[model samples]
Target: MPTHQIQIWFTCTVDDFSSSTLAQTFSTINENIQQVLNPLDAICHKPREDAICVSQLRNAKKVDEAILQERPDVKIFLPFRFLFWKPQDLFRPNTYNRFLAATGGDHVISLIDEISFRFPPSPPLSQIDDLPQELFCNGDNRPADCGPNCECVHQVDIPLNAIVEVVLVDEVQSPNLSHPFHLHGYSFNVVGIGRSPDQNVKKINLKHALDLDRRGLLHREFNLPPSKDTIAVPNNGYVIFRFRADNPGYWIFHCHFLFHIVIGMDLLFHVGTQHDLPPVPPNFPKCGHHLPPITFDSGYH
Candidate 1:
């Protein structure tokens, strides 16, 4: 588990008419807090000028100031940084209502691995209900026909330490959002992204297909180690990475593209122990029940 503190300073200006909506907004925030934490205890919701300050994990005055100055109704704000014993992802539902009330979206930060104490684990189905239907109901083009366990195999755990290898390749071209990429159950290391100039682009009439795998310029670079969640890939370059897939679960590795993924450009990875993958379903051979071989080849095909 890793932790990142996020301070959100936001102002909700209220006019006479805005009061009703504001009340509704506050109700949503308060409900989230009650459902997730003890309001009088872990969570705090306070008003500051036209703003609200929310601190999770370590606090930074700079993050607060920058967020506040983004608007005028905002006023003084600061967060008292603190580290805790058990690292509950501060992003979990309702842990911080002030931030929720302000951001009004599904954004959160991991503060640590595992909650401080184990309560009766919520039923898996209950947790599944909380997830967006598109995530597994297949609206996202995910193959999960029904919810978890509805599929033939009941395997539903994501290993946190299963080793994985990744390679990202890009062709020389003007930057454009190419694909909506996604990792499986885990994120990986950000090795680096290099670029090369293409004199070929300067010429016209010599028709050229934009190759997404052309390599060489050596522009911006990153060398961070592995972690969980999304890691960005450059628009016109390559990214190489490695990660562990210790978690045992059915995971999807695909571009986030809603339609593109439905067509193709999506694959799956099974990070089981060194043991060979289970046999593919007799009926759906194209579905690939096993892991794909890891290769880092890059070239126009």
Candidate 2:
């Protein structure tokens, strides 16, 4: 029997080996197998020469190469290797535009943190009126204070069968924390992720992202974007994703962190109207308190 030769590629950062023994072992392994100290160096380190132009807009000019070169290095957190370091910027969108021209969206939705609405000064509850009580009820019963004017629920209604584009921005206050946002029913294509190139912009928020979009600085990769149900919104940055809303029902989109979700770092995406949903099954199990009225028997002692 003949043995087949196998090639191994080890990838890591310079900071991976903290202990001398581990570093020596890695060095020994490198002598026998090829190693990649930093994989992103090949992909993102070099300056992009091609101009990024948006096709959806008529006669859109290509974005300057000089501006694209200013994007920050893509950082990542290896939880098993480096557990103590701050959360890092793991990914960024492709430098040039692709595929989006062919797959244009029907609706654009903005996902923002409390900072956008000034939640700390004003409560984090939903201020929008006429929200359905069934949607805002805590468990099966509505809170005593909650009424037709839902003060406890925050949600966005999405039309059925529409292609939806979401612009998710990081909170200005927690610039160092990466939020892992998850949508319940459908996975989305993460087409873009980036921060403002301007050094003067200390924090990137929804408004900053809008301004960048207006200036044609935010690029979207519609061609072969990774489909994900959950994605980490880069620390101090923003992420743009798109999905087709064919599902007709209520869905929650929220931060994966339990504490964050508890504190209202989430919202409901009411996809389509109640009419779009299938009829409830007859005699289906229901939620709510059910109790027979109790009466003291006269003969009871």
* Per-residue lDDT over 19-131 for candidate 2, one digit per residue giving the tens place of the 0 to 100 score: 97465554544244443321211122122433211111111223322212323222111110001111121123532211111123311111233210001222112212333
Cα deviation of 154, candidate 2, in Å: 1.4
Please report the candidate that would top lDDT against the real structure.
2
TM-score of each: 0.31, 0.51
* Least accurate 10 contiguous residues by lDDT in model 2: 76-85
Candidate 2: C-alpha RMSD to true structure equals 18.0
Clashing pairs in 2: none
Q: How many clashing residue pairs are found in candidate 2?
A: 0
